[model samples]
Target: MLNNIGLPGLLLIAVVVLVLFGRGKISSLMGEVGKGITAFKKGVSDGSKDDEDEDKTLADGTAARDVTPEAETDQKKV
Candidate 1:
């Protein structure tokens, strides 16, 4: 379906974008977009590591401690 647009249509769209934004602004915008994508990927990777750490902590089985109702009330008082 997209093959119908061809080179001419793509060039027209590029020209329109260039006219609207100018070359420097478009280049800066693309650079910012690339940086944003990189940051997002890094964040996802870091978050996945955090998740794995949590999973590993949970797997150790000693992390889950039962809190008594009295302990909860005492902590809340603080």
Candidate 2:
């Protein structure tokens, strides 16, 4: 379907976009999308770290809800 449309189809889409949004608004929209992607990645990484900390605490039978630098040494002190 896409291959059949080809360059002329793409140009028509671009023209419609330009007519509807103009260049500056489109650039700003793209920038926001990039920021959203970055923030989404950060959130995913943060969630993974939280999960890892949960697993670590569960495996060790610790009462701490979250891991911290002090928590790392708590086990050593015991």
Candidate 3:
């Protein structure tokens, strides 16, 4: 039923919203949205750097490190 809101209808809606919440309130809300987007981008780049640091392999073409416990190695001797 909402497929018929043409240009005039949209303008009426915008006028009603402006009357209800003035101009200053809307501008401040948009400024907060811009800050949120910048912070999200920075967080994603930092996480990628941390992941790369943990994945470095040895220069001689071996695994990064051995994770086996000492007890597990002794059990293999039996």
Candidate 4:
């Protein structure tokens, strides 16, 4: 449905938005959007670094927690 927005149509929309919200308001909104994008990128990179860091403990430099379950006989009656 959005395939029909030509240059003039886009311009008209831009003009309408500019009229509804003045230059200062739009500028501040854009600035906030820029900051949000930057923060999102930073968060994604940090998350990847955290995933890489998870391999920080084995003999081969990778971590693996023990998950072996003990036999029922290993538990004595309380």
Q: Which stretches of candidate 1 lie over 4 Å from their true place?
A: 1-3, 58-78
Summarize candidate 1's per-residue lDDT along 17-54 as a digit string, tens digits.
99998999999999999999999999999999998778
Inter-residue clash pairs, candidate 1: none
Candidate 1's TM-score reads 0.68
Please give the CA lDDT of all the candidate structures: 0.89, 0.88, 0.87, 0.87
Local accuracy of candidate 4 as per-residue lDDT tens digits, 1-78: 999999999999999999999999999999999999999999999999887677666667767776555664456433
Q: Order of all candidates by TM-score, from best down to worst?
A: 4, 1, 2, 3
Evaluate model 4: give its lDDT: 0.87
TM per prediction: 0.68, 0.67, 0.60, 0.69
Better of 2 and 3 by TM-score: 2
Worst 10 residues of 1 by lDDT: 58-67
How many clashes (backbone N, Cα, C below 3 Å) per candidate?
Answer: 0, 0, 0, 0
lDDT of 2 by residue, 1-78 (tens): 666898889999999999999999999999999999999999999999999888667666865564468977898899
Per residue, candidate 3 scores C-alpha lDDT tens digits across 23-67 of 898789888999999999999999998777667756575669768
lDDT of 3 at 58: 60
Q: Ten-residue segment with the worst summed lDDT in candidate 3?
A: 54-63
Kindly report which residue pairs in candidate 4 clash with one another. Answer: none
Off by over 4 Å in 2: 1-3, 58-78
Better of 2 and 4 by TM-score: 4
Better of 3 and 4 by TM-score: 4
